[model samples]
Target chain A: MNYCSDCGATVSLKIPENDERMRFVCDTCGMIHYQNPKIVAGVLSVRGEQVLLCRRAIAPRYGLWTLPAGFMENGETTDQAAAREAHEEANATLRDLRLYTVISVPHVSHVHVIYRCELVSDDFAPGVESLETRLFHEHEIPWDELAFHTVRKTLECFFHDRKQGVFPVHNLAFTIALPT
Target chain B: MNYCSDCGATVSLKIPENDERMRFVCDTCGMIHYQNPKIVAGVLSVRGEQVLLCRRAIAPRYGLWTLPAGFMENGETTDQAAAREAHEEANATLRDLRLYTVISVPHVSHVHVIYRCELVSDDFAPGVESLETRLFHEHEIPWDELAFHTVRKTLECFFHDRKQGVFPVHNLAFTIALPT
Candidate 1:
């Protein structure tokens, strides 16, 4: 954001005449740049009573298990992103995929949208980004080793909903106290 | 990702002897880096027959109308993120927020998760990030001026579901071709 896209001039942070908060405004073109959070979508595909999970083969949290998920791309909707991730990571085709959860993690600059998908086929294998892939029954879930907090929370909610037979909708956030 | 986070040594993208894909592996610390897409969450708060919409005060699509939404935080669940965004952008408290849509926009690096929230209070003003805020009944919506394609699709789905009184439980992504 150092250089202005409009006029190629250096941008500076300043409060607008009518507003109190600071904004990155271009000195030459008067363009104000505003950055917003990105969206990530994925699917929690299930077969019978088992949930599908993928072990990462890449960085950030390599070797950790996660649902098949990815960032939304330009010109694509969130559901397409979820299905594409599932197809790419696990080689799974999902049907009747339902919206499961929407979690916002502002600090990390991401919002996670997870879906509950029914397994349409058992045909699956590790994609380019996966180290290993498999299914786990509820009791056999690797709760202690799940990769991301959002994935963990989605699983917890799924199990609870299954047990109660009443999927109570909720929107909540967990503030992670990162070590400074 | 080419340098080791632990020892600051050069890392290499190496294919495991037995595997097919390349992986970024640190020789000194044996750490592997894997990057994945992130999730985004937002809420569609409906009051009676009208829905809440906000004009963007930020760029990428500034001044266009959109749903109140943002990214998920580290420790929060999807539901939490949705509610938080609703409160922050609209100053509106929500109750019985239900999962509405999971859209994947892979080309843009995000998955958008939207929820249908019940507006608990009418007390609201423009948040720091919004240019303006207002409620629009179905017939009054500015369809052509909507900010994002995902937002437009979500609203369409909401109306479709409203008509049937039977919300389809599935993730759907529309591959939209935006004018460059």
Candidate 2:
């Protein structure tokens, strides 16, 4: 941040008193601007034996297939955010929601929490942010065209667990490899 | 926030085009400043049949007892944040961390995530943020003296789960009553 949002004064990065990390401290207000990771809430909405996927119409992996998800908003639970994303991105309603995968992507400062839920009905359409929304069987999933690693990982876990007729919450951390 | 952190411009809250929520928009730079809920990571450190608690040396609940927790910092996983908080507040190291209670406190826009872990050693002391650190047996826990709702809920879930010998991850949301 170039300026303090509180005082409109220039800010400098420094370690505050009794703190070990460097933070943006305002010159005038002395306010510390702290930034934390964000939660991306989404859902793996299931029909009989298929899962819903939305083709993004927005930038940053545009046209790629992904589970309906987005940055969680304030004043909402993670599950609420996940359900809302399903409605907003794919015009889909979900039921029987259960916490599935919680993956920490520290390199991008994002915690992706995906819920495994049953689609309310087969009456979903593409929402504004999606070019198309469709249900795909496990063998038909666009694995190579998936938008993100978190989505891919969640699906991998879901299908593997489905065979055993048991689903367990998965907690994971992912790191992107730096260029050699 | 009164000013844009990006350009030092005055800001006004409004719903941007194609958006449902009101966000601070910079008058000069037109930067949208969106705010979201933060994650508070903590731990329930166990030794034998006791769990650790820290007395706060900080504001909001000075001297009140709680599980060691703090606002999660950037570039860290939730489990890492929980471990760091235990070390920072109680001078405690933990092992065998398992995801436990995840509670969303929407009134304050915070998600409190606590991990159940084993205390590494009995050599522990209060850290800078704690006035005292102590281990309490289930019967000796100061239920009414707990600092936060999330902590209480976590402990309640833990003890109840311990009896069944099955500790399933609990996902919950808490709401505080507004003064009548």
Candidate 3:
């Protein structure tokens, strides 16, 4: 950060007294600007043996398929965020949502949480951020076009555990590949 | 946030196109600064039948008993943050850590994650952030002097699950009490 948001003063990167890490400290306001990892909450909507996937219309992986997800906003729980993302991206209503996976991607400074939710109905369409939306059975999933590793991992676990007839919450992490 | 950290430009609080919530937006830099909930990662270190607790030396609950926990910093996973908090608050070494509780405090926009850990040794003392450290059995716990609800909830879950002989990861949420 070049300037402190609190005071509009120039900031310096220095270790504060009694602290081990270097942080952005403001010269005028004496404010410490600390940045931290964010959470991306979404849903893995299930209807019978099918799951919902949306085609991204935005950049960074446009045209690729992804589950409905987005950066969580303040004042909402992870479950609320996941449901909201589902509505916004795929126009899907959810019911009986359960936390399924929590994955930390350190490379991107994000923790992704996906819920296993029952689709309220078979009716769904693409929202503004999606080019298209559809339900896919395991055989019809476009594995090669999945938008993120978190999505792939959650789906893989979901299908794997379905065969076992028991679904346990997954607490997992994966290192994101650094930019070339 | 008043000014853009990237360009030192005054920012406006407005809803961007296709976004439902208002955010701090810098017109000059086209930067949208969004605030989201943070994860407070900690450990519930158990030994035999006792659990570790630390008395806070910091404000916001000075001298109240709590488990070692703090905000998850950038570039670190939840596991690392939990371990670091243990070291920084109680000078405790922990092992065999397993994700135990995930509680969403939406009113505060924070998620508290606690892991079930085994204390490496009982030779820990109070760190700078802690006034005193001690091990507490179920009956010996200072129930009336707990620092936060998440700590109380985690401890309750731990003790309850101990009796059941099966400790499944808890995904729970509680409405945060509004600040007075």
Across the candidates, what are chain A's individual TM-scores?
A: 0.90, 0.98, 0.96
Q: Report the lDDT tens digits of candidate 3 across residue range A7-112.
A: 7889999998888899999999889988888999999999999999999999879999999999888898889999999999998999999889988888778999
Q: What is the lDDT of residue A111 in candidate 2?
A: 90
Please give the ranking of all candidate structures by DockQ, highest first, separated by commas: 2, 3, 1
DockQ of 1: 0.19
DockQ for all models: 0.19, 0.88, 0.79
The TM-score values for the models, in the order shown, are 0.62, 0.98, 0.96
Most lDDT-accurate candidate: 2
TM-score of chain A of 3: 0.96
Model 1 scores a C-alpha lDDT of 0.77
Query: What order do you get sorting by lDDT, best first?
Result: 2, 3, 1
Evaluated on chain B only, candidate 3 has a TM-score of 0.96
Give the poorly placed runs of model 3, Cα more than 4 Å off: A176-180, B176-180
Worst 10 residues of 1 chain A by lDDT: A167-176
- Residue A64 local lDDT, model 3: 99
Pick out the ten consecutive residues of candidate 1 chain B with the lowest summed lDDT. Answer: B1-10
